[model samples]
Target: MKIHFSARTIAFALTSCLFIGACSDVLNSSKSEQLMTNPTEVNITSIDDLNALFDKYQYNDASWDKGNREVPRITFAGVDERWAEGSKSLPVEIKKMIFFRLMTPLALVSNENILREREIVKNSPLDAEKLKKIALKYDILENKTGNLDESMRTALLDRVDILPPSLALAQAAEESGWATSRFAQEGNAFFGQWDFSGNGMKPLNQREELGDYRVARFDSPLASVEAYMLNINSNSSYLKLRVLRSKLRAKDKAVTGIKLAGTLDNYSERGQDYIDGLRAMIRYNKLEQMDQAYLSDNKLIHLTTEK
Candidate 1:
């Protein structure tokens, strides 16, 4: 009435156990990785969460990227007298200056890929496609009038290559301290660019006191960003950078980061030191790792709900 197991069955069972143990996939579950992004990800599952994130974080590129891409979407349409159209994260230690809201996607393309592309393009000559691209950027030359208004449609377009969005964002972030500094809050200035035309918001705690002293201003953050780009495309100092970028594009050459950045000496009179700071910021923050979505002046993420 008692059951008995054979020696053969015992041996088979042991062997099976050993085999399964050796191939212990059951125990060895896939090693899943949890990737952590910069500035940390929060429980921003709603439009309200976005507003809270933007409010809590103050003005910074990280917040800008998160808000623009994740939540309600940063826009420049309606707002108070404050130049804030989108989200901003503050870094108060920085002086009163424009803080750039580094758009992730566009920044990545312009600063990283496009910069490299320029190099590749520079090695080559003016091809139909390349010319088309260059012309498109300089709409006046393209005669396309895609985004150019009537005023800018006739102006000469000089830049022939597209700056990688990342480089642009990186520069903006570095220069503006992640949209948290003083300039962005008061005047929507993000590029640390000075408009000597006696136009712009004056520093709140101006050391000079009572001067038509300069800064740029815009009704909307998008306008400020557009103006900043225009300033770059129009400025003389950036001419070299643009030329280098264009040459790199024309010849299909790789654009050197150092060389390209050299054109930003005017970005700060602190000279090479400023350049060093920017590079350091990019490296330290790994800001270059941000998404490269090109957030055009008019481009707004039309999202009313977060699903």
Candidate 2:
């Protein structure tokens, strides 16, 4: 079954809009709040039903239709638990296709939110108050000053930019095992983020030295993607990656996934070996082409499961 609701009919004002299925609640900006006021909802009971919906929307899972890279605005609030078991019956190629297609919209939408925030950061000089809020939001610990100086602006810009979709997709695939891992299936944790707050899922083989840290959990897949991007942008360990991206921007070069993937040596314990795996995934899947992809300017499509 399917349902559609115009923004006007939703009983809430535009000021409170959240773009729920695509935009992350934790990462919402003014521009992000303005999108997808109207949404279409589809209910599915299995992977086949989900694929049928994709077909109906003309969402091609095959290489973005040979480089025509406009992705349909099909977002899933969360994955149906059935997919994990049902997908095992499918071939590897088909499984990869389904996972990529399911995840691409979340990555694209998260990037869109960051780009909007980046625009605000770019014009930070005009509003010191807004600049301070942004700096705090992105965890700029160096800037304790009330003033929004050029240096602060530069730092915020370095940390507020969009991540390449290829890198995000590759990491999600590797970390969550294509959303079949216990963390992803139970908690929507795609990137294996650790939380020391004692409100997360504990791993079966957690090291005692790491304390009581557990993998961070999220309400939705989009939220997981949002948190992952925020971690990459603001975490101290990924500073080198941010610096490399800024250097690429300074040269007016494309900040590609392959280029930034080189600096992710600190992201995993395997260091260079983990970096090699991510690079291989990006190249093998031709995910670099996804960097140019954007969401179609159509009504948002939310995929849910039948009750």
Candidate 3:
């Protein structure tokens, strides 16, 4: 629950992308003009302030290269309510840019944590009991007492991997309306996950036949990203995606976002159309470039307050 961000080194760290100009050429050129903005270094009290900070750092596709895309380690402790309200008045392009910049680092950081867990699963001995605990945590373990076996290890490897940033970004945009949804603004629920439990925000238009289901909420945007990734990695609903990813890994093929996204037919009731929409968003925004991006090696900057 400790959402963190930093002010120190944030200005320079976020601007690091300005140095790398050799990334993918697949980036959308039509939106390139929206990337630049006058730099502003001030406390984030409004959506405009956050936009200025992103502008100052050049945190956009124009700065991210294909192989060498290193973004700053900037994170927000929480989304300011003002951002949700204020973004309504901003131009569509500016709002999109801010949404990308805000969500990108959170997704990368979540993926980084998952990758570390993956290493633990990958390197540990097959018989290690800790593997059972890990597998159980990821919802892949049914037997409580058994030596971890090859099959379990393979399953763990399959589920513990990192998700493509493009996929995550696309879903967040589609689900949360570019972080402008009430769930996103109030509950940090960026992925539109449902909760049957009582502890959730009831949807205004929820179908009565669906019971008292509400959107899952989180402590912060980063928490939302982490929960969404976990759901994709372990939920039975996304088994197809895990299978596809594992197949790509076995074949030694690069597991690009677009490729894995095809397996998400069950993600929404809209099925194939939902998948097509995600792909279109990814292509239109050139989100694939973000898959290659990484966090800088700077010291962690912890900002406790959004104000």
Best by lDDT: 2
lDDT (0 to 1) per candidate: 0.43, 0.75, 0.70
The lDDT-based order of candidates, best leading, equals 2, 3, 1
lDDT per residue for candidate 3 within 1-307, as digits (tens), equals 0112343323323332111111111112223212212211234443344445444455544454424477655555445455555555555665576568767877887887787678779888876776677788798777777567788788789899999999999999999887768888778889999998889999999899989999999877777888899999989999999998988989998887899889999889999999999999999888898888887654333332222
Off by over 4 Å in 1: 1-102, 105-157, 204-211, 255-259, 289-299, 302-307
Residue 47 in model 3: lDDT: 39
TM-score of each: 0.49, 0.84, 0.78
Better of 2 and 3 by lDDT: 2
Runs with alpha carbons beyond 4 Å of true place in candidate 3: 1-42, 45-62, 65-68, 127-129, 143-146, 302-307
lDDT tens digits by residue: candidate 2, 3-84: 2233232212111111224433533564444456556776654445555666665666444465668877666655445556
Write down the worst ten-residue block by lDDT for model 3. 17-26
Tens-digit lDDT track for model 1 on 145-176? 34433333223333423554445656666655
Task: Score candidate 3 by TM-score against the native.
Answer: 0.78
